[model samples]
Target: MSKVVLVTGGSSGIGKSICDHLSGQGFIVYGTSRNPDSLNTPELPYTLLKLDVVDEENAKQVVKSIVDREGKIDVLINNAGVGITGPVEETPNSEIQKAFNTNFFGPINLMKAAMPYMRDQRKGLIINITSIAGYMGLPYRGIYCATKGALALVSESMQLEAHEFGIDICNLAPGDFNTNIASGRYHAPILEDSAYSRNYEQVLYVVNKQMDDAEDPAQMGIVVEKIIRKKNRKMHYRVGAFMEKFSIRLKQILPDKVFNKLLLNHYKL
Candidate 1:
């Protein structure tokens, strides 16, 4: 039987690509939007479910609805996330909380909601869409890095915990991808009087340019398909341009000060 897949944030960007690809490949795909009714398009390759990942009860109900309808859910792609950028010192606490709620707690709640069904099935897969940014702290994006980094680590632990129950949890961190994330991301205002103003503005420009020139988000869909097909999967995977993937390795091997210097120079800080 083809796998029944549930993907969050499937209305656009990486999630849409994943949903379209999986549905085309014969998987029963259910993509999610916060307000599915508001979307004008009535036809898509896959079904769209209503979901607000931050809502705990909503998350649980979505899972139940899927299981109740399909009678089984073989895969859950925790692809819902938001981008946030700003100096750590100047960014508001509320904005930081919102980012964490969407990028961090949202994924956790979905996992919590879906795990019991997966445990009962004794065979399930979850692929978390993290980011290359998670591997290191970058200028003006410290909190964004922190949120993804925390999720990456938590996935590590969750995989271990879920293994005994016959479920596999994995993280797939993509580098810059051409997507709507750039437009949707929260960018803290560049205040002229703040100490971080000049540096923050410079770094933010670089970050935005990177997103503008990023490769296709469709590549992420391709990677997710490969992960789903694999029987023996790694605890984590990364997809990006050669240098983007290489940067993760550089962080693993480079001395702290040297790596920090490289980042500062790269961002022209």
Candidate 2:
């Protein structure tokens, strides 16, 4: 039987790309958008369902709907997330909590809801789409980095536990990808009078430019398909430019202060 796959945040960006690819490969794919009615793109290769991962009950309902219809969810792609940016001090507590709720807890809710069904089948795959930014604390994006970083760590523990039930949990972190994520992201107002305004503004420009020139979002689809086919799947995977992927390695080998210097120089802070 063809695998039944669920991809969150499927209205656009990486999630859309993944669903397109999987559907092309013959998987029964159900992509989720917070407001599927607004998309009105019935011609899509796969079905689009309504899901807002931040709502636990909504997440459960979506999962149940898939299982009820497909009989099993072979793969669950936790891709729905929000991007947040600002000086850590200037970023409000409410915004910070909201980012965590979406980027961190949201994925957990889906994983929790899907695991029981997956456990019953004793054969399933869960891919949590984290970020390469999670590998370190980039200036001005402290909150975003923290949220993705937290999810990466949490996914590791879940992967270990899932092994017992014949389920595979993996974290696939991507670097900057050409997508419409910039428009949807939360931006703490860049207060001109704030002390960090000049630096924040500079870095914000660089970040957006990176997104503009980044690799095609469709490339992520290819990577996701590759991960799905791997016979010896890894607990974690990364897909990005040479430098973006290298940055993670640099952080691993370089001293804290030296790596910090590299980041400062790169960001021109």
Candidate 3:
């Protein structure tokens, strides 16, 4: 039987590319989005479902439905997430709530729902798509980074526990990929007229500029496909050219204060 794989956030950007690649690789791929109707393309190689991972009940139901049809779940990719930028102090409670719900809680809920079937089968792969920001914090991205960092830590602990059930877990930390995430970036809500307003404007400027200058999404999609195909997958896979290398080496070669100062200066924070 073909291995059944479920990819959350599979409608666009990196998710769409991964879906396309996996379907081509002969997996019984199921891609999901909150609104499947928004995609105006012909039918894809894989099945597409309406999944809002943030909703715990919906997530559980979707996983059960997939298991009912497929008999076994082989791969679960927790790729659904949103980006929220701004200082922690200035960012609204609602925006922070949404960020944690989408980025952190969504994956946790899906993983909780998928584990039962995978444990029963005694074979599965769980890939959590995180960011380099998960490892290294950046100015104006405190909330987003915190969510990814939490994911990375959770996946780490999950790997140890899942292995007992014959399940393999990995975290994919991509530096920067060209994605609609930039175009779809949600501005942090400005709740009041205060000192935070000026800082918020600065953050908006930096984030918007970076979004305008991101890499192609297809490239990272290909990398994700490669990771899935590997027989001995590492605990973490960092994709992207220069950014990954620089992030790794900078931590080794530069002083902490020096590197942070450079980052602050570069972003004009």
Candidate 4:
């Protein structure tokens, strides 16, 4: 039987690419977005389902509906995420909540919702779209990084525990993808003359200046599709330019002080 694949946040960017890649691979693809009308899928072989991952009931209902129609879900890609950038102190509590809800809890809820069907079949693949931020902390992205860091741990624990059920969880760490995700970032609540104002300005300046230089999201789709199709997969896939590899390796090999120096110099801190 052809595999049934579902991608959350599939209306655009990396998620859309994943949906297209899997559909091309002959999987019956279904996609979910909070705003279903955001997608224009006249050409893609995908069915779009309305889902707001932060809503537990809504998340579960989407999974249940898919299972009801397909009889099984062979793959679930938790690709929905949002980026909120600012100095940690200046970012509002509501913004922090929004970040965690979409980035961390959203994926977790989806996993919980889909687990029953996967556990019943004793097989499944769960792919998480994490970031290099999870591996190493970045200045001004404290909340955003925290969400991905938590997700990294979540993915790790899930991999260890879910293997017995014949399930696999992979955390994909992509650096600087050329996606509208950055352009689509929710701006931090602005406060002029605040102590953190300068830092916030500096953060957004750095982010805005570099976002256009990020890698293409389609390549992310290709990498993910390969992992999904593989019989055995690694726990993590680190991707991006020379800078990304160097960053990940430096964080792994260098002492904190040394790595911090490089990071500061890289962003001219």
Q: Give the range where candidate 1 is weakest over 10 consecutive residues by summed lDDT.
A: 204-213
Give a tens-digit lDDT track for model 1, residues 90-141. Answer: 8899999999999999999999999999999999999999999999998888
**Cα misplacement distance, residue 226 of candidate 2 (Å):** 1.3
* For model 2, the run of ten residues with the poorest summed lDDT: 34-43
Model 3: colliding residue pairs = 178-215
By summed lDDT, which 10 consecutive residues of candidate 3 come out lowest? Answer: 182-191
Ranking by TM-score: 1, 2, 4, 3
Q: Once superposed on the true structure, which residue ranges of model 4 sit more than 4 Å away at CA?
A: 38-43, 189-192
lDDT of 2 by residue, 1-269 (tens): 89999999988999999999989999899999988887757589898998889999999999999999989999999999899999999889999999999999999999999999999999899999999999999999999999999999998998888899999989999999888888889998899799999999999988987776798989888888888888789888999899999999999999999999999899888
Ranking 1 against 4 by lDDT, winner = 1
Q: Which candidate is the best by lDDT?
A: 1
Task: Write one digit per residue (lDDT tens) for candidate 3, span 148-171.
Answer: 999999999999988999888999
Compute the lDDT of residue 215 as modeled in candidate 2.
88
TM-score of each: 0.98, 0.98, 0.91, 0.94
